[model samples]
Target: MSANHRPREGRPAIFVTGAASGIGRACAELFARRGWFVGVYDVDTDGAQAIAATLGKDNAVAGAIDVSDADAWQRALAEFWVHSGERLDVLFNNAGILAPGSFEAVPLARHEAMLAVNVKGIINGCHCAFHYLQRSPGSRVINMASATAIYGQPELVTYSATKFAVRGFTEGLDLEWSKFGIRVSDIWPSFVKTRMAASFAQIASARALGIRLDPEDVAAAVWACAVAKPRFHKTHWTVGLQASLLAFATRIAPSALSRQVVRYLAR
Candidate 1:
């Protein structure tokens, strides 16, 4: 790490993937303002650098990383460890992509891309950052999942599947990593007003529910997860009213009824 990148002693650190924009950027800003060192990593080098510059050198470090690439994840984490004083207080797996259209209309490659980033990316981050998190007391991993994970959505099949994977991974890991003092949690958010959401504005579900959440709304949930006291079973945090209602319905409603509700909204 460069002189400017050296960690500030006693400042908690967070490594946020996809920190160039959207929810990731919001989390970075919020964390930095709250006196945490931030690692801003994204595939967009310039954008990541811009965010770092905005946050100031002492407060943040920036790097380019394609979350789908395991080697890139390794390199980014290694560098982050240096700047964060070997601390990984929070690993925010917020980088993900989506393709909304008829399931068949979206190309297979795009679906695979979504899986690589949304699912594999979280796996890579959690697996690679294990030791750092183990060393830091009260470390937590936060994965960005979608409300679509509550039930499959028609136009968002692959993206929904990926979040379901994240949800499962977070649950399993939280149990497995408890011995290491690492808590794993995922955030479930309904559509947010971001460029990514804009791309799917025409989808029936988006048209019906509307994009009521903002990036900051989801970021606040992430912050909550970061500071929340550990619990035996609180592994999922829903970000919006829609997401909370959907999560509640899935728990109480019959499977057939839940399916019909999804169908009605997605129609």
Candidate 2:
């Protein structure tokens, strides 16, 4: 059953958190195309199931579970192991959301939910993945960071903070996970087209903060990192030309960059 698509030897199962949509969906699709056994986990059961169905029984397994839930992670992994019969070769921590508003305007519940789903979810995924990731040599984990991690976005201070946390955690894990032969990389994507952010105003506002990576483009980056030789890259590849420039300029001249951001975002 397993050899029909991917190689019969070595770990070929790839567990993708947030696999129902956006960058995660793309990564799942890429891995499935290569005959890899893909375990698609997401809160959206229908979305995950649709992707798995398209990939065929030999290549993909779909499960609906929120990455933020530790227990859910355990249950989903148990199911994937039973179904796929292999440890995850690659894990993409890609479930996240956009909280757009000023600090004062945003509710505490929204903020907490964002932190739980974005920051804590990655932490939980990493912890849940340890044993499985250790089972395979050269297994990889890709954390979804952002250009905002490089600097502050006035309108998105909280979101920026979470991404910075992801960047910090990924860098730290890259060193700690090396002994287990699991390569940890962060994908810093810019504004991507996804249902998660489906509003034109949202897109326009994001441009003001320097984000512009199409979902497919970021997905390609994830696949590239998975097959590449292991390396500790504290700063991974970023998409979106505008966002990349903003990130670079923010480092060279933060004050100047902030002013530009204000001007661009202001009507």
Q: Name the best candidate (by TM-score).
A: 1
Candidate achieving the largest lDDT:
1
Q: Which stretches of candidate 1 lie over 4 Å from their true place?
A: 1-4, 231-233
Q: Which stretches of candidate 2 lie over 4 Å from their true place?
A: 1-11, 199-212, 231-235, 254-267
lDDT of 2 by residue, 1-267 (tens): 121333345547788888888888888888887767888888988888888888787777788788889999888877777666666778888889877777788898888888998899999998987888887667888899887686666667788799999988998898888777777888777677787666335434565554356678987888777777655343376777766776677767868767776456643
- Clashing pairs in model 2? 191-211, 191-212
TM-score, candidate 2, is 0.87
Alpha carbon lDDT of residue 56, candidate 1? 88
TM-score of each: 0.97, 0.87
